[model samples]
Target: METSSLDQVRAAEFASGGATAYLATASCGLLPRRAVEAVTALAERNATGSRGGAGSFDAVDRARAGFARIAGVDPGRVSTGGSVAVHVALVAASLPAGAEVLAPEGEFSSVVSPFAVRGDLRMRYVPLAGLAEAVRPETALVALSAAQSSDGRVADLDAVRAAAAAHGARTLLDASQSAGWLPLDAGAYDYTVTGAFKFLMCPRGTSFLTVTEEAQETLPVLYAGWLSAEDRWNSTYGPVRRLAADARRYDEPVAFLAYHGAEHALALVAEVGVDALYEHATGLAARFREGLGALGHPAVPGTSAIVAVPGLGAREPELADAGVLVSNRAGNLRAAFHVYNTEADVDRALDVLAR
Candidate 1:
């Protein structure tokens, strides 16, 4: 896309409606204008009882395709989930009983909670540095975030996958923090999960779980609802005899309304180009680091969108007071950059922090 047109797109759609500089896109991103219209249209249709379920289904299908494009995989591999945590848990539950789940210590709770709560499995919290050494014969899976939410450190997925594969274990990656904003070879892992609420620029409650052929072979269908059937609308229910022949067999029904907005959000990402978006975001982050460094508040270096400043917790309220939004992660202020972010946003944040 043309640079001028892209800037106009961001200004007209992303920055309208009193949008803030929202440096917290790593957490909860702003919903784009197209997405807002999608949700509104769907709600209106439903309220009038003219809701074409076909439109909702198309939205879901498009959403699946959108995420698949980002993950560099076919749509057949992607499944819908209400949220990342739910799908992560479902995937965890499918593992062999009494198996071991190796995860990084201080990882996001959603990534670890599902495995930790599994009574039949043992969860080992190891450091990111210890992941390779921790893989053992009993290890059933290695769970990790593609980008560390704490400091935005991009995981060495190739190394992690190789280590897990050496022990005949599957690898599950949470791409929630990195997917829409970063260039990821997501198909490298056995399974991957991401949500649309963050950098995808949609509302909450839309998650995509992509399962590789290896994962589908070993992972059991833990849950199968109407949406998981080959003929979902076939209400001729007898004993639930037929299941989908693909990964959809494990999926459950989600809020179709949310997906209408998610589809539009994903379209926006495609228009902007994922690789270009990552470059744009990281460029802004580099500028942020330089500016903050000059102000004696250098942010820690990392490859992903989030820029973490160590020990800046006390400045949270001050930032909010200045209309500059950021988040506190691991006792530091985290300012995230995305395709919608501008240099002015970074300058505003820096000016506020310098106070």
Candidate 2:
């Protein structure tokens, strides 16, 4: 698709981020106009004491459905949460005592730290490229990010899944960096978690998880609350005779304003289609990566939405001051391309970095 074609989306949905170029979707995505309005509407409703926040459940339900569609899973398989770490903790607690957990080295703390804190579980780390080959018979679970945050190297989902299956180990995929643009098959993994703020372009408090039926049977509903019941109204002030029949059993009380925004944010993702965003963003990333190499900067090589050049982290402040927004991650200058960005945005950042 031509670069001009995406300008309408940038103008309509993302007209407000105060930057000459926004290449920081890896850090946080700018909210769309519709999402801003949705959040404002919810705040006004709350101010008027309408339903005392009961209306949030409707938004929460729609967000759940939107995420289910984005991740290619049934709505019943998805559960709402405020963060990835909490969901990781739940999965971590479900493991057998002293079970060996395998993960990629430098895996995000939200994924690896939960298992580490357990201390009972044996945690093993391998290079991201070798994750599949390292899976052993004794491995109980393989937890990792779909795309690495520090550097945007995407994990090989198929190879890892096949390896885990052969070893009878479960899989937990953190889709935080890949969900909005990268095509995701949440159902293929035993469990998948996403902190949607970064790429899904929602409020910070929104996150989601998908649990397979076999995996669901294994995870204890340790975080159950009123929403955990099949009928929440009946669940109040009781022994909770019937819990949610599906993954909803793991639901937490949502951040009301956040989900209200998420409802619109995820709708925008559905409207654009992940494949289109993938083509657009990766095209911009490739352009930027090529530009960086020509400038004698060595970037982490990949066709990922994020492109990071090492030894250039110190340039981030100067780049931002020049109005080309980006991030510095683990000593690499990281620029994330997203649907809202354009060729001009990429070139503007490149131009600033060249100086």
Candidate 3:
């Protein structure tokens, strides 16, 4: 695909929904043609009953390769799951018992629920601004999202990593909102979790989890399945079963179709280039905010693709009626841009908001 420029991306032959302005990449992204094709091919294989054969289901391997590329880690370090929620639970299960986890209030429930449900652990909710100060001796891990799901505000990852390091605490990041839209250093954190359905423009039921070397050695495997076994195909029914030494051993059994779709989605992201995509989306968001400002519906300042406009919460239906699609968050309207978004879409949205 010729995705070198925004014009090329806007005009590319892809399967973007006919929304005047989608602006909801934060919720769910439109699937690209490559991803669609992958799913279609997988369906064909399944129809012939050929998908269940050995080596026929290479989707998991392909999807892991995609994640490894984005995370700057070896494919062996990558794990897959049906959803980010499942990955979160796996990571939580690996933590040392009785360890304290520091997290922010109002975090995405999936990110909080896994730790909260751990009876052996304690969770301390702290503001993002006070995260560093809240890290204490008992803090074994610190968790937060790379981007705020509500307002699209980005977290200072470097600072957060430093703070966690100072306290000898491992950093666990939820990168679901930022995975395809932003550049991520997965190896920098002790563990990183993300899904492909959002910015990656893949189907649901595909999530990636990356763990560092330290995390691999210290964390215990609470959940085990044949797919994650050291010898996955081994018919060993004994009480003593061996596990894979890499992070892949922690993966859950996910649908092969999800992996097939994710492989193509990640390929599309690679073709577009993450840095270029981020710059283009950010530029579009800035222009979007500017247009709204001229229309007396100013967007909040943000570096992410999401632009939040106050007082538009009640007017969501009104905007939708005029062929605009956005999400309501924290009493604000969140219009999120993506690689598929164009200036024309922004203008269409602006025209509706102006009314």
Q: lDDT by residue for model 2 over 202-260, one digit each (tens)?
A: 99999998999999888989877778999999888867779999999999887988999
TM-score of 2: 0.97
What is the Å distance of residue 46 in model 1 from its true position? 1.7
Candidate closest to the true structure, highest lDDT: 2
List RMSD in Å for every model shown.
1.9, 1.5, 2.3
lDDT, candidate 3, 1-355, per-residue tens? 2344655655663655665667788888888877787788878877787845322347778878987998788998898887778878877887777989899877888987998897889989988767778888789889999987887878778888888898899988999899887898898999898977898888888888898877888666666777667786682465427788798778776687777888888887887788888887888889988888888887777778888887777777888887788889888898888888888788888887777
Which pairs of residues collide in model 3?
Answer: none
Error of 2 at 29 (Å): 0.6
Per the 3 Å backbone cut-off, how many clashing residue pairs does candidate 1 have?
Answer: 0
Displacement of residue 312 (Cα, Å) in model 2 is 1.2
lDDT of each: 0.82, 0.91, 0.81
Model 1 per-residue lDDT at 215: 78
Sort order, TM-score high to low: 2, 1, 3
Give the TM-score comparing model 1 with the true structure, all chains together. 0.94
TM-score of each: 0.94, 0.97, 0.92
Model 1 agreement with the true structure over 144-175: per-residue lDDT tens digits: 99888888877777788888889898889998
Candidate 2: residue 46 Cα off by (Å): 1.6
Worst 10 residues of 2 by lDDT: 1-10
Model 3, residue 65: C-alpha shift (Å):
0.9
Return whichever of 1 and 2 wins on TM-score: 2
